[model samples]
Target: MASKYRRGFDITRDSLRVFTREPSLLLLPALSFLAVGSAFAVLAAILFQQGLVESVVTNDLYKYGALFCAIAISSSVATFFNAAVVHCAAQLFEGNSTSVRDGLAAAWRARRQIAVWAVVAATLGTVLYILDEKFGVVGSLTRAVFNLAWALLTYFIVPVIVLDQRRKLRDQLRRSGSLFRETWGESVSATLGVSFIFLLVALPGVALGVAGYFILDGVLAVGALVGGGGIVVTAIVGSQTASAIVRTALYRYATTGEQVGPFDGRDPDTVFPEN
Candidate 1:
């Protein structure tokens, strides 16, 4: 267990280094968030103009349906951007120079696949949300478990969409599941390491926000809030980018049995070594 955690931390540290080398990669997630936020704002405005917002808020069926569509749209946008980042990270692993333009182009090329997967993911997410909202504690627990399982199973979906565009969506999902099974231990470790790093990164911002509530006044307090919020956002985006890069590296190592410099140097055989 100790060895596993060490390896996970090492992999995450290396992943962060790779991200720092190309801070531009973090722009993908930032852009995705911006685009999705803009879209949702526009959507809300339209709904309000149409006087459907009241219905959506009051009607259970309409509410869930609207939530479903919103979640689906957000998921699709996120998947598209994530696929782009995966493409760029894969290029980096291959020693090829890539920019945001290259990543966007790659994502555009795989847009259809991303759309298909997004619908599947959105459907599952909507169902889970509905279950948790409508049912009692048991339903909420089930949704939580299923949500984690879904995340674990689809860890490599972005890489598959970026690297194996020819495969059908179901096939890609199956491949992701298989690859994840082989590297579940490492994946968990990497996730934990990333989460820990994120916590560390956000701690100062959190402290500032708390201190602002007590010590600062008016404009200074608002400045603290904005500054702290910016740091938290940066940390979130950085951690997410690192996680995606690590996922891409793991997928390449698992599929090609080749080490890609500092990103991946583990033995292919050891990926699923004999017990």
Candidate 2:
């Protein structure tokens, strides 16, 4: 356990170092969030204007259907940006200079794969949502288990899609699952470290928001809200960028038997022990 934790910490620290070297990698998540938010806003406006929102809200079937569609759209946007980030991270690992524009271009080239993955993800998400809403404690527990499993299984899918454009979606999924199973320990450890760092970074923002609500009023409160929000956003972007870097590095090590950047000192076999 100690060894696992140490490995996770090293990987997380190295990921942050990569982010410090190329802070622009953070822009991918910000752009994705903005694009998806805008799309959802437009969708909401259209639904409201057409009275579709009211109908959907009143009917469970319509609500789930609309939710599924929204989730699919959002997933596509997320996959596109995630692929771009992975591409840029791969370039960085290779010691090649890259930019946000270059990353975006790579994602655009893999748009079809992104769309297909998005549909698959959205369907899964919709089913999980339905399970949680329709069933009681058992359903919620099942959804949670499935969600975690899904996350682990697909951890390397973005990198696969970014690196191997010619492979079909099913092939990528199979490869991702195989890779993750082989590196499950490292994957769990890395996730633990990232989650710990995220909590640490986000705590200040949460405190500030709570204090603002309790002690401040009017303009001061508004200022506090904005400040808190900005801090949270910064933490989120930083954590996400670090995560992408670490994930790409792990995937590269798994497939190529070559460690890059922060991974150079670590033994690839140890990092991804046999299942």
Candidate 3:
């Protein structure tokens, strides 16, 4: 267990190094956040203006439709930018320089695939959302299990879409799953490693927030909470970027059987053997 975590830490650190070199890759996740946030805001406005928010809360049809639409919009936008990130990361791995435009162009070229996957994702997400909303703990547990499997299987979908020639959704799904299966250990460890590292980084801020709640009051307490919350939020964003880099590197290795950039010289089997 310690070894696995160490491998994850090393891989995550290397990915962060690559991220620092091309800091602009951070823009993709930031744009994804803004785009998804804007979409949700517009969706909320539409629902409230139409007085359908109450209907959504009461009527299953309204609720599902609203949820589906919201999921579709957010998923589409996020997946689009994710593809862009993967494209740029691929360029970096391939010994080529990249820019945001290059990434956007690659994603734009695969817009149709991204749209189809977004709809599929939104449908699944809506179903899971309804189940959790209506079925209580059982639904939540079921969704959690299903989501984990879905995440593992679809891990490389964006990379495949942007970096491979497969166009059909099923074809893309198969490719993603295949790549994941081949590198399941390192792939999972790398992602979990990124999360664990960020969690550690965020813990201090969380501790501050808790400490402030107990020991401080008024504006000072609020300020402490805000400061701590800011740290956590920043860590979350940084982890997203770092996670993207790791995914790109993993995808490149799984597909090409060669590690590039910071990932080079690391033997996958020795570093994080499959369990």
**Regions of candidate 1 where Cα sits further than 4 Å from its true position:** 1-10, 19-23, 210-216, 261-275
Per-model TM values vs. the true structure: 0.87, 0.88, 0.87
Off by over 4 Å in 3: 1-3, 133-141, 205-218, 273-275
Could you say which candidate leads in lDDT? 3
Per-model C-alpha RMSD: 3.2, 3.0, 2.7
Model 2's alpha-carbon lDDT is 0.81
The residue-by-residue lDDT of candidate 1 on 1-275, one tens digit each, is: 55644555566677767656577877899998888889899989989899998899899888888888898889899888988888888887777888899999999999888888878887888888888988989889999999888898888889888897755977987989999998786566566767776777898898788777888999999888888888887887777777887788778777876666334566534432223
> 232 in model 1: Cα distance from truth in Å?
1.3
Expressed as tens digits, the lDDT of each residue in 162-269 for candidate 3 is 888688999999999999999897787678878988898899999889977899999989999998988887787778777877888888788778886447898765
Candidate achieving higher lDDT, 2 or 3:
3
lDDT of 2 by residue, 1-275 (tens): 56655565676678767756578777898998889889999988988898897789899888988898899988899889988888988888888888899999999999988988988998999999889988989889999999988898899888889896645877998989998987777666666777676777788888888878889999988888888877887777767777777778888877887777557787645653433
| Candidate 3 collision pairs | none
Clashing pairs in 1: none
TM-score of 2: 0.88
